[model samples]
Target: MSHAGDGAEVVLRLDRISKSFGALKANDAVSLTLRRGEVVALLGENGAGKTTLMNILFGHYLADDGGVEVFGQPLPPGNPRAALAAGVGMVHQHFTLAGNLTVLENIRLGTEGLWSRGAADARAKVERLSRDFGLAVHPDAKVGRLTVGERQRVEILKALYRDARILILDEPTAVLTPQESEALFATLRKATALGLSMIFISHKLHEVMAIADRCVVLRHGRVVGEVDTHATDKGALAALMVGGELSLPRAEVRVPGAVLMRLDGVSTPNRGAGPGLKAVTLELKAGQITGLAGVSGNGQAALAEIVGGLALPVSGSIMLKGEVVTGWSPGAALAKGVARIPEDRHHQGSIADFDLTENAVLEGYRSRFSRRGWMNWRAARAFAEGIIKDYDVRCPGPETRIRLLSGGNMQKLILGRVLSAGPEVILANQPVRGLDVGAIAYVQSQLIAARDRGAAVLLISEDLDEIMGLSDVIHVMSQGRLSPAFARGTMTAAELGLWMAGQKFEAPDAA
Candidate 1:
């Protein structure tokens, strides 16, 4: 029953697949094939049915019509076990890890259930696997202590532990630092060389080009095109994903004025044993975007924490507007013209249960929306309405719960709150984490406008497209050290990716 068209070629195939929800056609006669040892890029925007299709394959949802074939064998509808038994494994965009548990416990949680017979064996194997794949995770480390990149490695290990031959990675690099991402790609390449097949889902076109052998573009819930990565460029792939021209314009050049924020000899305790920044020094100038571009785990979080007033630097001076503000409280940072949009919006940016109006004024509720040491409903409602209209935030009304909005809308609301106060400095980390093409454009436009209006921007994002689009100076971090390469104007994505993967480059001054 192997899907070897002429010997050992095709491994999986979907024929004329279609799925629907009420009147909406989620998948329109889509067809694709995964050849042996191939890495296929599934490209699409949000709500474009990429997840829907994957869900169908993973048995979360059933296709109304058509068939799924693995090794040329037909798969019954809505059977996850069958898929797993057939050698399919999936790593979701969101981690399904229990935060309180250790890495080994989380990995063995569901698979072993109430029994714990192979704990030692699994740990040893995971360690070996980590070393083999360059994943480099501590199996004994608590999941909560693990950075985003480490957690992702655990997820990948979990999939592999199940003996899966075909892996599905959903936006795998979305949270990875450039070095971690490169390490991951190296693992995937090794896996492929060992006869494993993979389907990689991502919004980043350059990642698709770099890691994938073939690319499949999805738009409006349909397969638009599939082509070899070697034959196409980002421009063409983006055109297919957006169904039109998707040109990301560069921010206008501006003369950066006074030092907005300065960090000298910044160092923090190793959040974990793996890597923590060492003697970090950086500066953000008023009216410019200083992009911190690193592979995921190399102290971006620690840096954000220190600058945003979440964590104090062990030994460093943080200057804001020419005044040293090291060890300042969040309130003090805000008072000194520093506003932060935390990396994880759900946990740090907004209160999910809070209404739109309430979330809109979360950071500034004391003075602007509250009065007489009491809640001011009128001002809050009016302010929320203004943000909705001005920022084009799509929501029911001011009373709508923030969690009810889409990821893009929530990001818009969070950004609206920060920018509304007109802070002189903004620390935006992964600002557009889960946005669509249109939403990304809107948010980028907002940041660009903010820069033009003289607000210094600290743009930290895993998406290189975003960093490249908005950064006045791109600072790359690798293994907890800042690279001296600062790219400007038109630079190739490959070069940036290389720098992000820890390649040594000449100093920015030399460039």
Candidate 2:
């Protein structure tokens, strides 16, 4: 398909866009343009102003000293309705769909009047779009009942239903499996064929290389470099984004020690309609990373929660350090030297409204930062300050709220808080999700360092590459059941994929 070139019509333009939150300038006089049928990749480290620029274009945040033009028409500042009316659509990294609503209802929401007589027409259009773009999701399905990939498809369909000519996708494949990501890319290609222009924001250099026609690099909230996709390589793009050579950390060979944590035939009840852990047996040994690979909602969260002490199995036993555990809880897990890096950093990992000092002590405040009935403010602040400095968290100070820091920095603080305690067992759930290349390397290196220090690490991720790369032993989860562990390099991705699809599993035992 023909894409952005010198002669193509410009569909969207951001001229000298600038935005600041208090003292931080998120977007510093940034300018960008999108042409008809073009896929422009917006590449940057976390907090490098990629999201800020897109938000300005979509009218989520008004530009301090610039403007946006969609289809040669000036868009009204700070008005999402105006942007939508002008054919601009955005699918944020975190979806904005109501869980209780149906797919059709979410697509039709805010676009039509209440009690409008266009229900049938909307359903028909949705079906057609789903068929044409390969976004296969039932229109009548409740959104909360859908998988992560299906939800993402619904988000895309929502934008298409609004006749969006220009689309902005932020970290679109962050939660998707390899197979699902490929499908999404196929849909994007189809969209481009239909003359839709897209601004693709992603931290995965390979995805940008595969899908984007051009790459626009942002650093410190300014346009640093722009390159044609065909002419540049991933390494070059990585350097452009981070302003240096990038090297991802690799897992080193180490003999695994004794089992630090084990779950034997564990079963937990379903979460809503989702499957829970069922007869799953797993072992985490010291000095090794045991990777769990699966599609989203396939008992990965259940397993992580069980290990992290968020939930206990309804049946079977949990053994920590070869001892049968009782009364397991977050504090209990911490006391037993289990450090958890939760999947959802914004919600589970750190509180949004709390300052860095407060969040730094969240998991250990009662035991470590408290004496008798009183709190140690000075010790807490010192600990918070230590994390900020040691972990390279770039923020104003310990007094700054965690919500104000970038995803990478926020993750760094979490890493510091947990690692500082010198845990013997580490539960890292999607540890590097949505992080830039630099941040990903840092986080992975830290995990490796922990493993080197004889920490038994349980790494859960949807990305097959990450699983294969970091895992000493790999297990695939499907239908809440765990497959037999395969040593690293013993199973190909396709073989593991079959396990993920539940094709290789034996029938469940009669209840």
Q: Name the best candidate (by lDDT).
A: 2
Candidate 2 residues lying further than 4 Å off, grouped into runs, are: 98-102, 142-144, 374-380, 506-511
Residue 434's lDDT within candidate 1 is 79
lDDT of 2 at 263: 95
Candidate 2 lDDT, tens digit per residue, 128-168? 99998889999999999887889999999999899999989
Q: In model 1, which residue pairs have backbone atoms overlapping below 3 Å?
A: 3-71, 176-296, 177-295, 177-296, 178-295
**In candidate 2, how many Å is residue 339 off?**
1.7
Top TM-score hit: 2
lDDT tens digits by residue: candidate 1, 130-215: 77666778888999877677889889888887778889999888877566677778888878877888899987777788888888
The residue-level lDDT of candidate 2 at 460 comes to 94
lDDT value, candidate 2, whole model: 0.90
Alpha-carbon local distance difference test for all models: 0.82, 0.90
